[model samples]
Target chain A: MQGVNLKLDEIRKAVIEMDDVKTAQLVNTALKQGLAPQDILNNCLIPGMKEVGELFTRKEYYVPEVLLASEAFYAGFNIVSPLIKSQSTEKKTKVIIGVVKGDIHDIGKNIVKVLIEASGYDIMDLGKDVSTERFIKAVTIEKPAVLAMSSLMTTTLVHMEEVIKELIKKKMRRNIKVIVGGAPVNEEFANRIGADGYAEDAMQAVKLIKKITIG
Target chain B: MNILTIKKHGTFKVKKSTKLIDCLAKNGIPIIATCGGKGRCGSCRVRIITPQKPPAERETLFIPQSALKQGYRLACQHKITHDMTIDIPRLKKVKFTRLNANYGLALDIGTTVIKGAAVNLKTGSAEKISSVYNLQNSIGGDVLTRVGASIDGKYDILSKLLYSSLKQLKNCLGIQKPAITIIVGNPVMLSFYLHEPVNGFAQYPFTSNLNKGIFLKNPPRYVFPIIGGFVGGDTISGILQSRMHKSGKNSLYIDLGTNGEVVLIRGKNIYAASTAAGPAFEGIGVTCGSLALPGAIDRVSYAKGALRFHTIDNKTPIGLCASGLIDLLSILLERSILKDNGRLKYAVPISSRICISQNDIRKLQLAIGAIHSGIKILLHHAKTAPKNIDEVVITGEFGSRLDVNALVKIGLIPKGTKKVSFNKDLPLQGAVMAIKNNNIFHQVETIREHSIHIDLAAQPNFQEVFVASLKLAPWN
Candidate 1:
């Protein structure tokens, strides 16, 4: 048990250090030592990512560092995720995400997508510059529990409201919790656009989605 | 009844509750409101010479308390409640007589700065060279930001700002509406100047409305033709100045500024790509970054385990400009104070107010990554290696001030290139050349006909290449 605890600590440290190769090697070693994949994931990888999120919020880590840490987290995650017994897919809540039309800045959206996936949620990424019709089509088809919209430019911020209006017009607003984010987005603007939630960063985004979905 | 009087300019009859900015514009006063009179940019600041109105909530955010105390207020935030007199600072008129009838004005509208040259059409020699900050910068510091602003229905405001800047440049050069004017800039800037919608640049399959040379009747101005996507008239101007299109040797031309446009010439093929390097190279987004002006640190050296630096005019160090940022990064990497992954070990203070932070290094890394990856991808598309390139031409605002060794040390330019040269204001030079010889337009059209634009974002391996290039190390 003590040896298992030490191995989990090493995996967490490797993630913080953004050492993808060391992380994959350590995860493989733990798996060969007869450790449960779920236990390794719950105890080591998620917690490592949680710390990374905290560091990002504190400004100690930036986009490049966060991206690298996410890479390291996935390096271990890919080796362990398939080995875990499949959960009931029906119980999982799906989130549809996209950058609004006229805005191609997706680095923030990509980060949020990774963090939310790491937290074990279903994500439907609609890439960038997605039109309003496409968002309505996805919401109508996917019937997602949450719709996440991002725009890095002030000009494109109006598209988020347009999506919300279209959702209301299609009578899909109540079925999905709409959340908006990006550099130009604020809680006031989100409220004005009738979005259910707003997140300042990726960590807040994941947490906001979790809270809105579970409630 | 209310009367609004400008100190030097004429007074105007105004109604109560009219926005000061709108009143000024209606009265033919050229005031810069980069945020379109939204009380955001503070560019339209005026000094109240009459009864001082308390600063508005937005004014407090942008104006310093001392300035406010001295009767300065944002024009957008002020309304004509009563009779008022104010002073506008930037409307000072310069006194200069027209020198000659055969003079031509050449203008390069950059995202950050607008440069102009007064040329003797007969001799093709520049009579005067001057530059001013692009007033649209107060809307946003980058091309995309301004494009977004234009998309948000601020096109008229942006166009007005461009004209005001041009008017200022004309005044500085002492040329009052030369017989013929030549304009060269990026696609977005040219579009803004023509009041054309920039919605095409807001998304993919980036189409430009100004792909051919246009002549305006009222102003007698000739706007240069753009290539494609973000590779606008400036790159065409650069090619014209370098004559790389006609050369047999493989040559790379890079215009490094807010937008890093790379053009590779091999045989008859001309390939170009525009990388959105942001304003990091211009020192807009960094913590202690500034434009290359007096008091701006433009060079740095590490010797005897200490860092030494020099400003543009041997003045107090205000902040790091592009060249200084590159030199400082090279010195930091040499001392291992900054990691290859762009993490700074600690903040290195150049002065009491200015320091190189970890965030600054990351900004530089992103910028360098964009340019380096752009060059690599262009080379990959051309089926040529960096070593095979015969000449590399670097041009932009930094020009001769940039240290070639430091740029190479920081891995911005490819390692072991055959020859490297720096040309100052190639776009301006090309515009002047066009004015001197009207037949150059035919050559420009030929070059445009042979050019191909590659969308860097659309490339499959762009993310991987960009990430790999982010390391502050020499090319392999």
Candidate 2:
């Protein structure tokens, strides 16, 4: 495949115009060449997903736009993922995300998952109503880089510490970077529970994960 | 002389009854009889063992013949003539105390106010209810302001303020301790109550860690399930107490407060969501708009092109009530004093007969538009329309007295929908129910499970409709 100069304007057009086919085609063309997956991801996928996240956060785009952009991002991710050398998997990190037990809310968790995954990270989504033991077991088995716990209830948030404590009990606390998010879990609460970091949003989660790993 | 006995459940003793109505009335019984106990409600019927004179017209008209044959006599009509035994059926003696008792602790955690009541459960009523402005008002008056406050190190203040308010309410009610505490509030309020972070509700996948149930080791040992934020505990309480869930027809329960929560119950399912209608209905931002309290103008009537209003105190003119605000908007629109698009017809020579202003129309438009847009989203999510709606049960202070016709004419509530109404204290009723039976927690969970929560933020057309609705001036 001959190299195509994937300029900023071209990538921005793919995102702003919401042309999934064009975005995927350009990313695939770049990947098929000697261009790095990391470059394509940072220049195209991250920025495109960031636009979707920002538009959603600012109330500019609604659910349909966000959903469509995420799908488009997924199309681009599929193209770049295979070309990334198997050794590059070590460069990326695994993160486990779930809504706490007794909380069946997943919309926020799902959005965060989408944004995080689009950021070139592997996610272990435990889904909603995830018990502390399940989180502990996942921590022990997969040993993900970051354990992202989410909850929508003020009442169910107390369960986050239990999961954190269980991780410590299993001697997996230092090995795992625990990130807590959701409507009720604040930075202070995260600090109180001894979590590694607290991301206010999905985009923030990506930044925090990047800082913890790449730094 | 006839003897009648009033007993609890199964056991009773014979007592001389000279005049049953007088005795029952003196005893503070609430018997439903419109004709002053002339047996209109058949609510005062009692069984008699001794044969008496033929049934009276009042008795025959209201009470069934079968019941009459089974010794049914109107308590008001029955008088002692000879020594006779009277059987007081469970229906007659179903003592209903003032609904204050059951709530024992009624907490109305409004964005601006936190009012509560400590009721007696045994009497199926409310008792010493207390109300106070929420201390969180100091941090911010609205949910967004509060959210901002939460984001900026003011979360503790909200928690402490509400806790202090609840404590004070308990003290005022002389409640030693509320056995089962039920909190009914907006999502923000609920989040603040449990000290959960609420900033997430302001963004995507909006929700908070709302406890489905709590088994507290504290004084109020049993913690009930929280309804949900946005369409939080208050609306959940409204649905439970109003029995809107049980209604056979397609119904909508709109609790118009700072956060207007709309619930559409059809068959076995509930479609619930909330629109940030702001504090317009509660008179927070509206000039001359006040709550449905004493001296507030709650109703408006137009006669001969003149707009007249009826106040809560039945006194001289006060500020406009929530309903009156909507009516005023509707009247302005109808008389061509305001445009259908919610603009004032300033060119027309308007006299003292009626007054309409541009600002008034804008205020009305915002309030009514929020409500209208909310209904549209709810209906759309439910895959139904206003025509499919069999009834609209309007709750809350603003909802109770809303002019249904005006609501339709101004396109607030849809037309042809039968408007069912309830007083502003339905949340109190629900709190009472929750405190009385632990089962209410499970009931709320079931209701929550059956409910389809539609996030207005997620609705693509919400902003478009909201902006479109804002064009209409003060919702008359």
Candidate 3:
């Protein structure tokens, strides 16, 4: 408590190490000491995940490691989310992602979400096997900056375009930047299906969304 | 209406504009359609000796222009219009174990292929073996894709197709019905045989009613116990075959088939995980891959800048089979043609007819990554590393033939692998084991309760490990 700045460093270190138990314990300790939630999130959880992503890109850490670190990030995020709501409110970038209707493969999508959240994005994960109506409804309600869809089967890849057309029918296509990816999807397929961008992997998903959002 | 005729095979009458995939499936010979004949994978290709119309646009995109010119077209994409001659080229190879008693059948129902061995109960040895491409593949090459195929009410047809394929395998042994039939497969394949719902596996917390084996009337059949949704009865059989629970040394048994299943043992504790390796090892999704048949390249070697290879039966190299695919990847790695990140310096031609594409390398990477990550996770959960393991047992018809060096170079096997063993058809072997001793069936139930099943998909670090393992080099 005396060294609040140093304690924040320790929290970041725990997240990087993917010590979820330690992360939860430290978050409670920092809050009991009356540390600011926003500061903790910005200085601890976010930086911790950023380092996890960097380690991942450098080939030092793999999916299992990042997944554990993401859990650690969430452990801190769960504690700080409610507390930060009462403090200063800053606008967060909103995104919606799900495996399209009839496809439940979400391993790649989940990784993309974790990496994106680490990069400081508010992700509304619709989860896998999401219905087109649910996707349309989420777009209308969440009005996210991007709507990402994924599928592992080539048969279900058509549903991604179906959602795109449904978006156009409901006048939501222009409102959201659509991105699609999975095993069977390629840039040409993305272009053919009217997606704004296509990401090949989890790391690319984050970069693709940032390019689309910033541009 | 038109008639489709094969020069030497036979003649089949077809409806006007009906899909060639459906036409073939209806005639009891479904060709390779990994994407369920949607014309997406371009696997169900056939030679059109006579054509009435031009090829589809996607055909040009998928097939080489020369092949397209020579009348090679995706059967799924080509529709029957006029009477034409077509050729479906594939070699049929089946092993005859040895014949003794009245027929007893043991089946290993794989996602991509269904292999059955006729057992002679009197001698406790396999009599004759026959395998067929699992017709459920028209549904998909993987369980999840098959789940998607079931959405269109084709699940019943899938079951029926499987029944017919099983009969065909049985008939090859000149047996009408085995006195007893024991079927073993992963959850998805077994569930299809059991007529369980496939859609349940595609949703959250993915559940399946595939737990425990069930007996059927009339035929005296037994479906093996499924440990978990994805773990299936196949892993249970692997455990029984390897006797991992009783082994003093830490042992790892891996079945490198369509859906890669891994089992780890540390004393009395057993851990299992299934990773969707995407049929890469079975030679399903690769560019020039074929099942191990006559004329299919099964091995490759390069020394002093000389490239040489051998076929399955020492025949001419028509296509690369499973072992050849792995060896090809290994040779490319050894020669620096393939980079650690799974990119090729350029397209490498293995033959005038067979060229290794960059896409093929990526597919292998994904397959290896899936399997390698699953192994790493199961080992991690056991709180152990690869070095601590005393034995590595690879089970599968394909894995049995793999060069140990290829696995080590590709990083599929741990660098510290000390005792490596080959288990040909581990699930089938277990099924045969259970058939010989019905008491072992009870042991499977015990095996299920004692082991821990890890859903690699749900594992937190699966993605990280998978991505890291995507490197085409050995793990340091």
Best by DockQ: 1
- Model 1, residue pairs in steric clash: none
Write the residue-wise lDDT of candidate 2 on B140-249 in tens digits: 34565557556667677657766775665566666655656667777777777777788776544566777465555575633345555567777778888888787777
lDDT for B197 (candidate 2): 85
Task: For each candidate, give its TM-score against the true structure.
Answer: 0.86, 0.53, 0.77
Error of 3 at B254 (Å): 1.0
Error of 1 at B92 (Å): 9.3
Clashing residue pairs, backbone N/CA/C < 3 A, model 3: A62-B464, A62-B465, A63-B461, A63-B463, A63-B464, A63-B465, A64-B461, B97-B127, B98-B127
Which of 2 and 3 is the better model by TM-score? 3
* lDDT-sorted candidate list, best first: 1, 3, 2
What ranges in model 3 sit over 4 Å off?
A1-95, A100-138, A153-181, A184-215, B6-13, B61-66, B91-101
Compared with the true structure, what per-residue lDDT tens digits does model 3 show for residues A87-126? 7577778999999876656767888888888777889999
DockQ for every prediction shown: 0.39, 0.01, 0.13
What is the TM-score ranking, best to worst?
A: 1, 3, 2
TM-score of 3: 0.77
True contacts kept of each: 0.19, 0.00, 0.16
Ranking by DockQ: 1, 3, 2
Q: What range of 10 consecutive residues in model 1 chain B has the weakest lDDT sum?
A: B32-41
Model 2 regions more than 4 Å off: A1-215, B1-103, B221-229, B346-356, B467-476
